[model samples]
Target: MEKNKKVVILNILLVGTIILNLFIFTSRMRFFPWFIEDAWGYLGVFLTAPILIGIYFMLRHFHKQQLVTSTNKVIPLFVAATSLIIVFMPTTDFLNIVAIVINAASVFLAANFLFNQNGGKNNYGFSRLKNQS
Candidate 1:
């Protein structure tokens, strides 16, 4: 597949996994406290394994230094979603800690990629930060 397409797909997967993690975390906290236990937390880790793999692939693309103008548009959304999760999540357990780390890492990466020093008009560095008319 094309490189840009691959980046887009990876971004989608990353965002989807973050959303799922947030949903599971919130539901467990607010409504189904008993049903969501350590096992479920482990299950979330397992479910999020793809994100690790996706990051690996994304890193490969990043090494190539290809501009991901369209894919960059997803960064702010990812940052916002994960930030909300971090703000609302109760960090009282190991699983919560793991989730916090994941969200933080996602935010850091998106922010770094969005504002890389190499960013320029042509290279927008994979992020699409432009004003629409």
Candidate 2:
């Protein structure tokens, strides 16, 4: 129960952070308070979701085990959904760019897991699988 609670809190915090970052990014642009160099590096803020979602799916659903398609697919689907959520909107702020990049990474991962569950090649790095194969 404690672990579950922790996971829930962590997930909430992660999401909150992303949203807050986006809000801050937008606010910063209004007054031009941020340095040009700072804003320049913030283009890929949306990718955070995809990356985290992918890892979360792999851990929660895969058990780090390789399985044939038509087996359990719930986690992969969850991952895709999360990926979509993380990748909500694009922002020009550095922080937003980082978040977007993470989100996009998650999308790739979720898609990979989804495909793998459907008997497709595993592109989302299942590091353990390599040793087995």
What overall lDDT goes with each candidate model?
0.52, 0.42
Cα RMSD to the true fold for all candidates: 8.6, 13.0
User: Whole-model lDDT for model 2 versus the true structure?
Assistant: 0.42
User: What's the count of clashing pairs in each model shown?
Assistant: 2, 29
Give the worst 10-residue stretch by lDDT in candidate 2: 67-76
lDDT of 2 by residue, 1-133 (tens): 4543433443454444344344434433545454334444233334544544553564454343433222222433443354344445453356445544554453454445443343433556455335674
Worst 10 residues of 1 by lDDT: 38-47
For 4-70, candidate 1 gives per-residue lDDT tens digits of 5655555566556655555555544535554454434434544455554556556455546755543
Clashing pairs in 1: 68-126, 72-127
TM-score of each: 0.46, 0.30
Clash count, candidate 1: 2
Identify the leading candidate in terms of TM-score: 1
Error of 1 at 69 (Å): 12
